[model samples]
Target: EDQVTQSPEALRLQEGESSSLNCSYTVSGLRGLFWYRQDPGKGPEFLFTLYSAGEEKEKERLKATLTKKESFLHITAPKPEDSATYLCAVQAVRVQGAQKLVFGQGTRLTINP
Candidate 1:
């Protein structure tokens, strides 16, 4: 079965604090590892697309990396606006050449100023 799981259902960080969220997944054949940030009541915004182990992607204050069985979303020097639900989704090779992504429950993060 293909599934994705996230840890620490929620996290609280002070302005400038750093932390990491974990995402574990099991899939038949991994086509891509995706990271997204979602604000309340809004759709997820794409962050990274990792296709192989040891690969890393980064934005202004966010970094994402993937491995064979897991992925990590690392936030550095976070700001108040950076607070959101960090969602990790996995896309695998599916029938009919469709890439179906299974998303994790997400790690809700809060940053206080």
Candidate 2:
């Protein structure tokens, strides 16, 4: 079974604080791993897509790295506006030509000024 688990179900940080969130996953025939940020009452916004180990992507204050079994989202000097639920999802190799996405519960991050 394919599954994703994100650590530190919730986090609180002061403005300018830096931290890393973890996303661990187990899957068969991996295809790609994805990251997203979702604000309250809003849909998730795409962040990164990693296809293989050693792959990385960055945007603004966030950087995402992927490995065979897990991925990390590193935030540097986060601001209050960065507060949101960060999501991790994975797509396994197509089954009967159909692709499915498995998602983690997400890490809810709160940044305070």
Predictions in order: lDDT: 0.93, 0.96
Kindly report which residue pairs in candidate 1 clash with one another: none
Candidate 2, 1-113: lDDT as tens digits: 99999998999999999999999999997899999999999999999999999999999999999999999999999999999999999999975867778999999999999
What is the TM-score of candidate 1?
0.95
Compared with the true structure, the alpha-carbon lDDT of candidate 2 equals: 0.96
Best-performing candidate as measured by lDDT: 2
Residue-by-residue lDDT tens digits, candidate 1, 11-96: 99999999999999999989899998899999999989999999999999999988899999999999999989999999987778
Off by over 4 Å in 1: 95-97
Off by over 4 Å in 2: none
**CA-only RMSD, every prediction:** 1.0, 0.8
> How does candidate 1 score on lDDT?
0.93
Positional deviation of 109 in candidate 2, in angstroms?
A: 0.3
Taking all chains together, the TM-score of candidate 2 against the true structure is 0.97
RMSD of 2: 0.8
Candidate topping TM-score: 2
